[model samples]
Every structure is written in structure tokens, then in C-alpha cells.
Target: MAPASPAGSAPASPRLPAPSRGRRPGMARLEVDRAFPRSPRGVLKIARTLVALAALICFLASDAHEAYTALAGMETVITGLFLLLYLLRLDARMRCLFWPLADIFNSVVAALFLLVVGLFAIIIKTNKGTLAGGVLGLILLVLCLVDVVLLCKKISLDKARGRSAPAK
Candidate 1:
């Protein structure tokens, strides 16, 4: 038997029990249900990544010009709606990964795009009166749709995961 610790001194170290099967000894057991990137920062990072991808597609695609015009026209309306939804989401305390300020800025950018689209459409209509801008607009609209769908899917998955996790 080990000698007892002296009075007023640190207690003797107790022998730790063996870890259960498949676990290593001395390793901590983490709560497996914990969510990944479990903070607003993580969410924001994900949102930024998605936004970057969209931007890249818009900038690099050779055939995007035709679609871009129509998309510009719709940008303001869609962005306003997005901003409103985001505000509501924040009010509800939803776990958004990105920074609120950044999100707001992004929404503003979307609105600006819409404004630009409108201007371009008007100029083209008045000067050329042709469907020259249709292609870019369509492409942009499609990209927006894809973005929305992906975002919804991600949110759904996150919510489902959150629900399935055991309470801390």
C-alpha cells in the first residue's frame, strides 16, 4: 500500500480506472455531440466562402455578361429581402456563422448590384432597345437561385444536427 500523505499536505494520487474499450488511458472523453465550428464566427466564415465562390463565378465566366444585366436589376430587391430575413434571424438568436456587420455589408453590396443592373437595363433599352443584357441577367439569376438553395440546405443540416445533439 502507498504511504499516506502528511497532514496539511497534498493527498496521495489515486490510481485511475482503466478506460473503457476502444478508448486510450489518460485521454479525456469529449462530448461527441458538440457541434463543429460552434460559434457565430464559424458560420460567418462559411458564408464568406460561399459569397466568394459566387463572386468568382460572376467575374470569371465568359458567358455571364448577358445574365449579369438581368441579375443586376433584381439584385436590389433580392438583397433587401435578404437583409430583412437576416435581421429577423438575428432577432431570433439563430446561430449565424458570419459577423452581423459583414452580413449587412454583403446585403448592401447585393442591393448596389441591383441598382447597377437597373441603370444598365435602362441605358440599353433607351439606346439599343435590344435583348443584349438578357444572358448575364439569366446567369446571375441562376447563380442567386443556386446560392439560396445551397444556403437553405446547409441551414437545414445544421439545425438537424443541433437538434440531434444531447444537451450539454
Candidate 2:
């Protein structure tokens, strides 16, 4: 048998401070804009995302051409990115770019393309899914136009008020 250790002869173990109760280890605290989702732009963006997703689904179900499916998918991603940019308040942090103008441009371009794709989808009349997708695309186009109008009005209002439009 090994010899017994003497009292107080054991090695000391270091003690560490306890972690804070409010946060978990290695997890970042997220700063969410609580009011963003309730704002008009946010609502429109949410609607756009849903509509784009529906259109994409319809095209996929109907075996439409890849171009149609790709357009819907691209719109979904772009809108989602914009939504996240606002929702997370990243736009405020990144002040170099004018977000409103970019948003308006995106809306206009998307509307134009959606118009052509929607019309083509309807004209082809390959199946019910294509028809449904076309209708949704048209609806999305309307929403995009509305978004552009709202943004433009907001910018003009800010200019009239003698103050620069806020980035957020």
C-alpha cells in the first residue's frame, strides 16, 4: 500500500469566479429593434417575403422553368436581407450607405422584373400552379410599388421638414 498523505499536504485547486446569471457562456447578446416589425416598412417587407416564398413554391410545384423559381428565390433572399438589416438596427451602425435609396431602387427593379415574369407565367398557362404563381407575383409587384412610393414620400417629407432623413 502507498503511504498515507499528511494533513494539509494536498495540492491546492484554483477557484474561478462564477459566470453571470443573465448570460450563457460563449453566446453573444443580440440587439433587436423591437419596434421595427411594427413599422410600415417592416410590415411590407414581411408581406413581400411571404409572397415571394409562395410564388417560389407554386413554380416548383408546377414544374415551371428554373428562371421563374430562381427569381422568386432571389427576391425572397434580398427582401429577407433588408428585413434583417432593419430589424437588427445594422443600418444605423453602418452609416456610409443611404439605405432608403437602395431600398427604393431594389423595389423598382424587382417590380419591373416581376411584371414580366408574372405576365409570362399567366400567358403560358401550363398549369394551375403557374397561374397561381403569376397572381402572387403580381401581388408582390403591387407591394413593391407601394414600398417604393412610401419610401419616396418619406424622403420628400424629410426634405420638406428641413432635416436630413434618418438612416434608420
Candidate 3:
């Protein structure tokens, strides 16, 4: 049996602790698109990252010129960023940025830089690492070009499909 409050007074309610904004250990769930890494585009991005890292390592190990080292390092970081964006499905979440066009621009610019720096590295090679890094850079250049081509083709197809649909 419970006692009622006197004089028509309301009962007091218990208060709850406010939730913490930060993620807790073992409690935070990262919604990664697991299927992404297995897709062709994801595979290509992964290959680009791996090659960029290899080139960076070669440059660092051989004490190649600063320009070669910088280019390799920058490319590795940028490619990894793109990979993370896709893996985490950020492209879908963040609607402001047009990811496909950005990706194409990145690919084209990277290809140009790699071509120039890679030739220089090869021509002025003072050690084996420089030569290897240059070759890898050339490989990276090809990969970037491939990425650009794929992205362009995909974009064109998407636009074509969109145009074929009846307007609302």
C-alpha cells in the first residue's frame, strides 16, 4: 500500500543522469560498408594506396630528393583519405560534396604530378631506391589515369540513365 500526497500535491519524479556525448569503450559501433572493399572501385583504391606507400618507403629508404619524398607522402595520404571516405560511406552521408567529380579531379592532378616528379626521379637517380620509387610513381600514375577513366565512364552512364527516366 502506498501513501498519497497531502493537499492534492503532485508526487516527485526521479531524475536520470544525462547521457555522455563521447563514445564509450566497447559501446561505439562503426557502420562500415563491408562490401565496399570487395568492389572493383574499392580494390583499385586499395591498390593505389599500397603502391603509394611502397613508393614513399622506397623514397625514404633511399634518401631520395625531397620532392620525390614529398610527392609520394602526399599521394599516400590523399589516397588513404579517399579510401576511408568510401569505406565509411561518408560520401553518402555528406551531401554537400560531389565525390565523383572530386575523385576525378584528384586522379587527373595526381597523374600530372606523378608524371613530372617520376621522370625527374628516374633521370636524376643517385641510388637504387630513387629508381624504384620512380618506377612505382609511374605505376601510380597509370593507376590514377585508370581511376579517372573509370569515374568518367561511370558518371557518363549515370547521367545517361538519369536522362532516360521520365521527368517528375
Candidate 4:
């Protein structure tokens, strides 16, 4: 007669295969986590972004004659802030995309603003006109608006999906 195996010790019935690694076992892979402004830093970023947007709107809504004179000296400051935020945001987003064309566009815009600011400062010192600076400021303002719109869309999508964004 064959020998009887001990209870609970029959070699575990030829153990089942281990589950595959590196993939979610049974659940859908969660994409974005929390929406924008979810953290303190993100809140601050959103506030600054809104402020920049408001400034742009104010610059555009007022009568050109009145706003132009009032906003002339602020061109450099606003553009600089916008460029800084744009670069920070682009850096944060770079890892999300394989190609990251947004990063490239942001870098190009920031470089252009830097050049404008530098040239504007030099020209002001030499009593030259401020037309070029004004134009650059307008361009940067438009770019900031575009960024804001894109961010809003992303945040809305993340919210709809009910996932927290992965921290950068």
C-alpha cells in the first residue's frame, strides 16, 4: 500500500503560479490623483496664477490710452512673474508626457521674455522707446492666459476622474 501523506503537509498541492509583477493586480490604474490647488503649494500657485490672470484682464479691459500709460512701467515685472510661473509649471509637467512639447514652448517663451526685459532695461537707460517692451509684454500675457486655460482643463479632467494627481 502507498504511504499516506501527513494532514496539511501534502506539498501544498503543487503551488499556484505567483501573480505577475509591475501591474495593478485587479484594479484600474489610477491616473491623476488630486486636482490642482489640492496642496498648500498648489494653492499658492493657483493664487499667483489667478492674480496674473486678473492683471492681464485688467490690462486688456481698460481703455488703451489710460491702461497703456498706467501699465507701461509694469510690463517687465508682470512678464517676469509670468515667465517664472510658466517655467515652474512646465518643469512639473515634463515628466507626464513622453515628448513634452509644452516644456519646449515654455522655454522658448521664457527666453524671449528674458531678452525683451533685458533689452527694455537697456533702452530705457538710453532714452529709447518702450514699444518693443510693450509688445513682448502683450505676448507673454497671452501665453499666460493660454497656460491658465490648459491648467483649468487638466484640473477639471482630474476631478472628473476622481484621482489625486501624483505629486511632482
Model 1 lDDT per residue over 98-161, tens place: 4333444554555456446634554555333222343344344444444445455555776788
The TM-scores, one per candidate, come to: 0.29, 0.79, 0.80, 0.28
Show model 1 residue runs off by greater than 4 Å.
Answer: 1-75, 84-130, 163-168
Give the whole-model CA lDDT for all candidates, comma-separated. Answer: 0.46, 0.91, 0.91, 0.46
Q: Can you write out model 2's per-residue Cα lDDT over 21-139, one digit (the tens) per residue? A: 88878766668999988989889999999999999999999999888899999999999999999898887777898788999999999999999999999999799999999999999
Badly placed stretches (over 4 Å) of model 3 are 1-30, 163-168
Q: Is candidate 2 or candidate 4 better by lDDT?
A: 2
Find the candidate with the highest TM-score and give its number: 3
Clashes of 1: 17
Tens-digit per-residue lDDT, 54-149, candidate 4 = 434433444233333334334435444544544445434445552224534543554455355534533553322234334444554555445555
TM-score of 2: 0.79
lDDT of 3: 0.91
TM-score attained by model 1: 0.29
lDDT tens digits by residue: candidate 3, 1-168: 667777877776688777767877566456799998998888999999999999999999999989999999999999999999989888777767878899999999999999999999899988999999999999999999999988888889978889435367
Model 4 worst lDDT window (10 residues): 125-134
lDDT-better candidate, 1 vs 3: 3
